[model samples]
Target: MCQDVIFHEIYSAGLLGEISLGLKRDTVEGLLGEPQDISVSSTPYILNYGSLQLSFSSNDPHATLQSIHLYFDEIVEFPHGLQLEGWLPNKSVSAEEFLIHAEHFNVVLEEDEQHTFKNPQIGFKSKADVIVVFTIEEESVKLYSIHLGKRPR
Candidate 1:
């Protein structure tokens, strides 16, 4: 059921098939059904859809989609055929494994300049200027979530 919701990367700028960046809030809901929850405390309101969360810009009258966050709790296919799945309750992808997959896809990742030994988060700007961020767990050195969004001005 989870795998049925595939988020395909389109031109490295937005998602395709299921949802895409710049889509209106209603469009996302129409595609994914109603969200499990909605978090409106932040500027970019988040619509929680199980393991996936779509953020929409609050500044726009139409509330256009701004970003996407996917948690690696269940098996999910990422760009370049990267399939990430968790074995434990807290599913995660090892940093080394991620690097290998990224290399396979020819996706170059730049380490966060503010990254430290204790906390590491690798990020890169895609050819379409979409910012890709991997949030890694400090203790396990595993990736917990992947975020895709436009580069902030």
Candidate 2:
């Protein structure tokens, strides 16, 4: 149970609230408040804000926010433009179907070797901080557990 949990809408350019790649760690911490858990014993710091997990790169002195993972079961919303092909949480859809619809948005979700599909263009690809990831099981994708990340340059 997280106190002061807020529903930050995901924006079309792969932004979750004020969070994005290259954002300083403190800025993210300020926006989300104290994380329920912080794994600081690793190179890339991991902060858990309830069901939403954020990973930060340690290469920078400030530990910039690198990626964000949100659970479908978690209570969060996306702006109309950022919604994943209009697929909402708890909505059942097949992987193939999702891939087809994503194409219309210029987002191509290709299955990776890890049995997941990812679209690099989900965010501002030019900045390399935006990507959309999905996990599939039994041909159906879980609405929760979707990941969005920006690579640390």
Candidate 3:
């Protein structure tokens, strides 16, 4: 039950909860405890913690965190009292509800035109340096994943 997870965009780089871009992997592990699993096969290694996944630049334990992915099973709260409480694989969130939630933070989601007809996800620039992505199920438009990360240079 993680609550009060703030997403800060004022700095051009966003912050989610206590984690932010360029945070050391060790620091994140200290904040969130040990991850359930770690995947090192990719360039940006992934650390899985139930509904949350953190990506780091390398496999080193101290690698800098690059991105975060939050799945909708657990309770995810934000400023202005916005909360998402989807219940894993069984429950789903409607696009309308999600949009309203995003609006609370002044986040405008634009359809990813290039992938709309195929994968169907919406995203927006959180700031000059941050990108927010919301993965939506094609037919239902149900939110599948929410990703926050630094925009590539």
Candidate 4:
């Protein structure tokens, strides 16, 4: 089955997408249909929607959703194709522009040694969980592949 894309929207208030935090597995299925595969090993349960992946916490007895990661040429939005305070993803420019946009929204980001930028506060449903990462290259940033989830304890 052809699955519709889950646009990752960075809003001034929070994130909006096909798969986000605090959703039940069934709700996710209702949103994106049955996933191509599911992983429930020793690690957190994962629902793979092609390139996009939704990771749920093991502690969730009801299987509440915890995180969302998008890669493999996924599209992002600020929820329903709206811009976040006039900030939107621009594919025409370099990745630096993306960083600038994030800064414009006053998003607090922490850059790792590998040059990856993460704003844990941006895309999580649980207040205690945060782990969204943006991959930046030498000349541009790859918005197609982003990570949204809780930090592992």
The TM-score leader among the candidates is 3
lDDT of 4 by residue, 1-153 (tens): 322122224323225444457778677666676677788563588877656577776534468777766553434322222122433343343445555654554454444434333532112221322233344445444444455554456
Give every collision pair in model 3. none
* Better TM-score candidate (1, 4): 1
Model 3, TM vs. native: 0.68
Error of 1 at 148 (Å): 1.4
TM-score of 1: 0.66
Please estimate how well model 4 matches the true structure, expressed as its whole-model Cα lDDT. Answer: 0.49
- Measure candidate 1: CA RMSD: 6.5
Q: What is the lDDT of residue 27 in candidate 1?
A: 72
Please, what is the TM-score per model?
0.66, 0.57, 0.68, 0.54
- Point out the worst 10-residue segment of candidate 4 by lDDT: 120-129
lDDT of 3 by residue, 3-59 (tens): 223432322336555677788988888777777788858687998887678899998
What residue runs in model 2 are displaced by over 4 Å at the alpha carbon?
Answer: 1-12, 59-61, 74-106, 113-139
Writing each residue's lDDT as its tens digit, candidate 1 over 1-153 gives 333122224324356455667888877776677677888676878888666778888744479888887676656433422233322213566666765655555555555444324445555444554444455564565556656675668
- What is the Å distance of residue 65 in model 4 from its true position? 0.9
Rank list by TM-score:
3, 1, 2, 4
